[model samples]
Target: MTQITAAMVKELRERTGQGMMDCKKALNAAGGDIEKAIDDMRAAGSIKAAKKAGNIAAEGAIAVKVADDNKAAVIVEVNSQTDFLALQDDFKGFVSDSLEKAFAAGYTDAAPLIADQESAREALVAKCGENVNIRRLARVEGDVIGAYLHGHRIGVVVTLKGGTVELARDIAMHVAASNPQFLAPSEVSEEAVAKEKEIFMALNAEKIAGKPENIVENMVKGRINKFLSEASLVEQPFVKDPEIKVGDLAKKAGAEVISFVRFEVGEGIERAEVDFASEVAAQLEASKK
Candidate 1:
């Protein structure tokens, strides 16, 4: 039998927001695998969802650059050890320079651009006394490209076919706000749909019990459709006007959304927690030696 440790329980609690005992039980059942425990808990409806970008602890800034002709755009994320450093002008300049280099070179991958900026990044880190990283970059090109940055924290680039730049900007703004996972319902994968069905069934087990097979099937299908709409961009209600869907808004403007990329600072990056009091006590004890 695998032993469940306190650290594992703490991690699971952070990821799923579950109670310590429940997380321990889940961890024990999964043989000390944290990811598996989370999946099992989610399947059993004990957790509605795992941690999201809002729960991310890391600090950073996102930058976006658009072409003069509105034909292409690039978005980049640069991470820092603390928000104070991220707010510093040097860090902000580094982020902007990274974005410009990626945009000028039309580079989709961040590696070469990061390598190019290594010296400047190192200089900033030395000056700030904190680690910094040029984390990721993405580029989008289409008949019309629009970019939007939400106060340096979130950046979005949207591409459209047969759309005006104004329309594209509006959609990009919507993407920055809504953070949809897919451009349309068709882009949602079958595996994602199946997982949603499993979660819905588990959460509604009592209500669905003893129902006719056809009725249960209909309920599952309804839930899947709801999930699809919520996850897809075109199907989502317009942020500006609740009465109309984004698809309808696009159709009215004779445009189709080609694709979009949304970047939020420190997304998917886990930062270690610090115990300042413990560190201070240790420092005092060492001083007495």
Candidate 2:
């Protein structure tokens, strides 16, 4: 075997971020071949990532980037099994690159873009491990698309028909801050509306029924109207100025909100549970050997 020197171990550790001892072990196992040892360490990391793939990385960062000429925009999310990876430079760059790819492809559908992104992300997993996922990608192309990124885990893409660039960007920022379920009241599902009404009547039935039946009917109507106002995007009170409705705010700014998409990372994705205490115990038991 080639000499496994301190310098070689150091180099291996720097390359893989594996512990010094782990690097030395891999180097030794690879007959002191640095390149082979790197491969070995990478495979090991991949295994580690796979074992923890069941963990939910519901928390991650959100980012948005706009195309030149300011005509298009992309919003993307990269989820990891832990926030630790989410904060890493590699993971952030991966998100940006994936978002760029989505825009380049002009893909508005989530599934096809994800499929196209799977290969590049899997390659990242080879280095960073399977904790990484191109969770969702969105693109907008119309008269104009503006983007806003609020920290990580919340990104917005707001499209407009004919609006000032500043107005579009502010609308995008508003969306990032106030997440709306749908663009218009017309888009709200009947089932969802019924469910809300059911819950409302159930909770206030006793108080509302004391009046005449006609009055109670009006009461329920009022409640349903309130629900629609609260649930609809344009009707909802603007986050920036609660005194004004969002649509009214847009009108005041001389902008029209064509449409918008807000993807809070892993909003609807079912995430697996992890038992951190038990996992720590198992690791401890293995370490004792």
Models 1 onward score TM values of 0.77, 0.74
Model 2 C-alpha lDDT per residue in residues 77-121, reported as the tens digit of each score: 777777777888888787877777777788765577678777677
Candidate 2 matches the true fold with a TM-score of 0.74
Report lDDT (Cα) of residue 83, candidate 1. 85
Candidate 2 clashing pairs, residues 3+ apart or interchain: 61-152, 61-153, 62-152, 62-153
Candidate 1 TM-score to native: 0.77
- CA lDDT of each candidate? 0.84, 0.75
Q: Which stretches of candidate 1 lie over 4 Å from their true place?
A: 1-57, 275-289
- Per-residue lDDT of candidate 1, residues 1-289 (tens digit): 8789898898889867889999999999999988678668867878744653123336889888888999988888888777887888888888888888888787997999988998787567546656677888888888998888899789888888887988888988999898899999999999999899999989999999999999999999999998889899999999999798988898889988889899998888876777899989999998997
Q: Judging by TM-score against the true structure, name the best candidate.
A: 1
lDDT of 2 at 74: 74
- lDDT, residue 35, model 2: 68
